[model samples]
Target: MSDKSAALFALTNSLQPVKRVWRQAATQIFANSGISMSLANLVVIVNRNAQGINQRDLAEEIGMNPGAMVRILDQGTEAEYLERRELSRDRRFKTICILPAGKKLADEIESSANKLRVQLMEDVSVEDIENATRVLRLLEARASNFLQEHIHEKK
Candidate 1:
């Protein structure tokens, strides 16, 4: 393989362990905090869109199926964490609103996540993190643009 190909291969191989460790740590933290990763994510998203977010939009944003989103929302509602309200003008559409309980849970989850993040990054230098974040953001943007262009070309 060429030097570029070899380097890329090594980078790709290295990413798996990093991703696995990060995910495992996050999962453990969430479990200990009495919430699943998906639920934590839902709480955070709902809390961020404080006014009210459409059910469909929320599902799409989280890359969840509409049915699954409904089930999750149902669970949250039952837990008194969220409320599904039908729009006054359009009964067909429902909005998901985070209740006070949900907000509190989201804050707790955020705090736990932040603590875990700090612990995980204890050995990493701030400069190294900044550079890595910059490179990752650039790669993400380029990859997104490439995908968009490719999709348009297919049309």
Candidate 2:
């Protein structure tokens, strides 16, 4: 690999183990709550949307398949954390609404995530973190554009 490619590979490769570790930590954090990371993420998104979000948008936002989104909705609905209601203007679409319980759980999830992030970021300077975030964002945009040119919007 070229030096730039090697460096990018190192950066991306290092993240996988950290991600695995965080998943394990998150599992433990949510052990008794019966909520996985994806479930918690769904609740957080629902809580953020003031008008509620439809199933398709929810699936896209969560980067999950529509069927998996429905399954997650089913789990949340059964747990009484959220509900899906048919939109008034669009009868065919159902918007996901976060119940009071879901709102509370979302808050807890945010708190736990913040705590974990703080722990994980220990000894890392704020400036360095910001720089890394900026670089990552730039790379993400570049990657998206590359895909659009080569794969998505193919000529």
- Among these predictions, the greatest lDDT belongs to 2
- The parts of candidate 1 lying over 4 Å away from their true place are 12-17, 32-34, 88-90
* Candidate 2 local lDDT, 34-78, one digit each (tens): 677788889989999967899899999888999877887898999
The 10 consecutive residues of candidate 2 with the worst lDDT sum are 26-35
The TM-score between candidate 1 and the true structure equals 0.80
TM-score of every prediction relative to native: 0.80, 0.87
For TM-score, the strongest prediction is: 2
Any runs in candidate 2 off by more than 4 Å, and if so which?
A: 152-155
Candidate 2, residue 105: CA error in Å? 0.6
lDDT of each: 0.85, 0.87
Residue-by-residue lDDT tens digits, candidate 1, 1-155: 99999986886677779877876777776686666677777888999898989999999888899898777887789888889999999999999999999999888877887899898789999999999888777877988899999999999
